[model samples]
Target: DQQVKQNSPSLSVQEGRISILNCDYTNSMFDYFLWYKKYPAEGPTFLISISSIKDKNEDGRFTVFLNKSAKHLSLHIVPSQPGDSAVYFCAASDSSGNTGKLIFGQGTTLQVKP
Candidate 1:
C-alpha cells in the first residue's frame, strides 16, 4: 500500500500564529517527500520538500520535518497569514528512478483568520 494519509481534514489559526499539518505514509520505499499548496481552482503548487536522508527542510515561511521511523511527516508555517488559507497536500515519491509519479494525501484545508 503506497498511500499517503492526512488524518486531519482542516485546521484553523489566527493571523501571525503557527499552523501545523500532519501526514503519514505506508510505503517505506518513498524516499522523497513534498508539500503542495492549492487555492480554489488552481493546481497544487510545491511548497517544500525533503529527502529521506534528511530530517528537515525549510523554506521562507514553511518548514517540513520527516520522521522516517514513524513513517510520518509534518509541515509548519510560522506567522500564518490570511493568504495561507488553502488546501495543503502531502506527496511522496520513490527517488530510485525518474518515474515522476507522486502519491498524494487527501489534503488538509487551513484557514487563517485576520
Candidate 2:
C-alpha cells in the first residue's frame, strides 16, 4: 500500500524535447508535493515543488503541477539536456509538522539523449 506511486518506471526524451513524469498519491492529507533529481552517487537535489493551494509552480525549465482532487501530480521539464538524465523522485508531506518526514514514490529514471 504505497501512498505515493510513480507508475512509470522510466522516461526517455531527446535533448531539446519535453519530459513529462507523472505521480499519484492515495493520501488526501498530503498538502505539499516535491520533485527531486538524483545522480548516480549523490543525494537527490530538489527541483520543483507545488503546494495544494496552487495548481502549478515553475522554476526555470522545470514545472510541477498538482491536482488535489484527483490526487495526481506531474513534473514537466522543457528542453531537457543530457545533463538532466537522472532518477526523479516524487515526494509528499503533510504540512502538520516540522518533523520533516516525507513519503516518496518509486523513482522514475529519465534518459535524455544528446
Candidate 3:
C-alpha cells in the first residue's frame, strides 16, 4: 500500500500564478514531513518541512500546511515562476535520522509556462 500519495502526477501553471500541490498519508506514526524539488538528474533539494506538532510552515514563496486530523498536507507556491518547473516529491518520516532515507511519493512534475 502507498503510505503516501500524490494523486496528480503533474501540474501545469502560468508564470506568476499560484501553484498548489496536494499530498495525503495514512500512517499516523509519521511525525515529520518534507517537500523536495528535483531537477532532471540531480538529487532532490529540501524545500520545506513541517512537523506533525505544527499546522503550518512558510518560507518566502513556499508555504506548507499540514492538517493532522485529515492526514493531508499541501505545498503552495505564490507567483510560481518558470524556474520552479521541476518534479516535486512529498516525503514522510518517523523521527528518523536524516540519511536521505525518506519514504517518498512518486512525485509530481510541475510545468510552468513563462
- Using lDDT as the measure, the top candidate is 1
Residue 69 alpha-carbon offset, candidate 3, angstroms: 0.9
Please give the range of 10 consecutive residues that has the lowest summed lDDT in model 2.
93-102
lDDT of 2 by residue, 12-107 (tens): 999999999999999998999999999999999988889899999999999999988899999999989999999999999988877678999999
Clashing pairs in 3: none
Model 1, residue 29: displacement in angstroms? 0.4
Point out where model 1 deviates above 4 Å. Answer: none
In model 3, how large is the Cα lDDT of residue 69?
A: 91
Which clashing pairs does model 2 show? none
**Model 3: per-residue Cα lDDT over 1-114, one tens digit each:** 999999999999999999999999999888999999999989999999999989999999999999999999999999899999999999999775556457899999999999
Steric overlap count per candidate: 0, 0, 0
Q: How close is candidate 3 to the true structure, as a TM-score?
A: 0.94
Model 3 scores a C-alpha lDDT of 0.95
Query: Positional deviation of 1 in candidate 1, in angstroms?
Result: 5.3
Please tell me which model should have the higher TM-score, number 1 or number 3. 1
